[model samples]
Target: MAQWIRGWGQRGWAAPAGVCLCLFLLLTACGQSAPTGEKCLNCHEGIEEISAAHPMESFACVTCHGGNPQATEAEAAHAGMRGGRNPSDLAVLDAACNCHNGLAETGQDHIHRVRTSLQTTYAGAIAQVAFAFGAQPDPTARYGMLAVTDDNITTATGQPALELFRPGPDDSPMLHRFADNCLFCHVGGEPLAQPYFYRSTGCAACHMVYDNDGLYKGGDPTIDPAEPGHAREHRFTTAIPFTQCNHCHNRGNYSLAQMEFLPRPDLPDDRPLTDLERRELEYYQPIAQFTLCEWKLDCIDCHTNGEVMGDGDIHSSKLEVQYNQCQTCHGTPDALPLLTTIDSVDHPAIRSANLNPNYEVRVGDTVIATTRGETFGWVLWDGQRLWLTKKVDGMVYEVPLALGTACQQKPDEQASQYCHECHAYQRTVAPLP
Candidate 1:
């Protein structure tokens, strides 16, 4: 026994049950893990680059859409994909903002301004509805769909913060109905499943255009034709047309008393509308009075980026930020419109113009500016006449400046409603059945 002990040592106890189980699981997972042999394009055939600027040759889809790009099958590959086939949705906006940092110093925060914009937050609408329904004491904006904050204050009307609104037990009954119906119109909110209401949420709601049909009309053969919620193409555009805006606005009227949305009775469902017919309907309501130029210019041509999108602040109402007026182009009958020169390559207007395909803003160009110094990049002053290049079609119009014209408008009192008293167009609408 003494000689055997000297020759060999005794063995220790076996591993614990947990350790043994972990080892087995590790080996099994290694064997059963998803295959990484194929790439995203192997299955998603016929898919083109998102746009001319974002060619797939350089920019990878995985960069914006988080997905298992190495996976061979659908579920595993699309498991973490942002916005579920929509990379630009607010749900996945953090990833989308990464691509928008190349414009300028302020450009890095472009998405922040949009996130806080009245369109996304719908703070003004919420405030109005809340006040009308007695959910709040006054019409001041106190809440939004999601809570948002602005660290930087740019304007006097910008709200520093907004609280997330939810229906409480003590809330008025009408708020419930409003919460159900009215919330669908915001930029990030999912549009109702209706013909004219079909649009992607967030930035895609505009940039990624959708036709009335809401079906895939792109070159991607893999996309299902039966699906009814895809963009018209896998592309982005800044030269947005009035039709794009029509998908959200001018679709219908909402009754606060009834708490219901009534589709436009004038809108014919059976057939498409002619260009003039569509323009007449889209300009405003049937009873609305507006000038001819209101229809001639697309919504984006007049509404500045800060006006349409938020300017890093939450507003109480759309009118609070809607400063664009008739005299922005037409003079005050006393002086020429506000003029400024583009002198820097890195100007915000240059970056803004570059996003679109229609026109360019170059150095030494004299363009009109707002009273507050924001440049109107499209309008050019040649010291004689102002020429405006249309964002939608690139057609130039010789803007008649009121240097010597008989326009007796008080320069400060030149809002659209005021001008309508003089130049309100009377066009015939399609007769109702």
Candidate 2:
């Protein structure tokens, strides 16, 4: 005790005291040992589905979100919180995402990818508009040729590079319209109107799901409410459902399936839709007659993280992104490898599939190790039966793929086109009663 006092005295009393105070604040901020039992945790303890990487004991609420961890009162505790409820906002990304600095192999380094993504920047919109006005050579040309350094004014293309693309001043009217109306859905733009659609730009766009009715109760946190609603759960999970993706994918004019241009005279607002009307609104032309897997499975079931989040490469269009075809899973006509034996497993593909927890191995099974030495034991199939699992909810399904039955498609010759040939509603008929 005497030696400790002497050490402090040598370093100057005030400086030593300040150091001790900083250390105490850091410990408290991380929720190591809070005198009042971690005020944030007191309210949020009910939400047990936080990411496995971020445990409550080691990573406190205040560490990523700036707030007064010492404050006992609600208002005071949330006073200086950055990005409000969304930590994935670019403003707070540096502080919140420092942990992912070295996790490129696991695809945790998503901050840089989102910043440069065509979906976030609307680079495709810019390129198309520029090409329409003869400013660029091709509509399919890359955004890099335009030389867009910031949010506004591309330097190399679109009439006068220095000024804003507006009607009165600029030569390109189409480019001006794109800049005015079409540019707001990107990363830094305003939040969506629906509370359930409240996803932050960059990382949170895909990972988080804000249940407004259950969590916010009355209003969204991104928009100020008359009376602030209690946030029920911070649902951050890799197992994203198709409904969560419907807001952007289904409601937009530019859909991946080109369904926006299709004729839909059935939907007249102000009345609840009938079953047929709902079906028409939901599915596109050929997609309406797709197999059960198309309707039952989540988007992430087929499209892995590297395809969606990106492989640290800037793509001009969604088509350019890497994805799995039907052949990748079901196999070619000549060969169909059943994932029963350890030697038969497609190790690289299986390792890639296991990136998300939804496709992870079941709790207790024979662990199949990848070539990179990561082990996974969840068996999706044996030699005889296919043990398929749904990604949205952990529901296991076993189906027989034998020949000379109602299912005419042979297991050995299963392809996407082959499955669609017989499984489509138009081709299928009811069994004789």
- Model 1, residue pairs in steric clash: 117-310
TM-score of each: 0.87, 0.63
Model 1: number of backbone collisions: 1
lDDT of each: 0.73, 0.48
Worst 10 residues of 1 by lDDT: 1-10
Residue 28 displacement (Å), model 2: 16
List runs of model 2 lying over 4 Å from the truth: 1-38, 41-49, 72-76, 139-171, 195-198, 211-232, 254-289, 337-359, 362-379, 398-433
> Pick by lDDT: which candidate is best?
1
Q: Stretches of candidate 1 above 4 Å error?
A: 1-38, 101-105, 268-273
Task: Write candidate 1's Cα lDDT for 1-433 as tens digits.
Answer: 0011111011112323433354344334323222334387887677766764554654456766768878877889988888888778876787654544222245556677777778888888889888987888988888988888877777888788989978788888888888887788888888877666688887788888887778888778778877887778888888788878888887887888878888787764454778777677656677688777777778888889878876667788887888878788876789888889998876777767766566667779899898766788887787777777777766666776666877777767777888888888886766456
Give one digit per residue, the lDDT tens place, for model 2 in 1-433. Answer: 0011111112121122333454464455434542344577554445553554454665667766778877777798889887886676766776766555334554345665555555565555656667767666876535532232233222222221112223345546555555555554566555555443354555666666544332443222333333223233454676676655653554445332321222222222434766444443444333345666555556766565555654444545555554355544444344432333344223433433343454443222333232223332332555544444555555554433333245545555544667777665442322122
RMSD of each: 19.3, 14.4
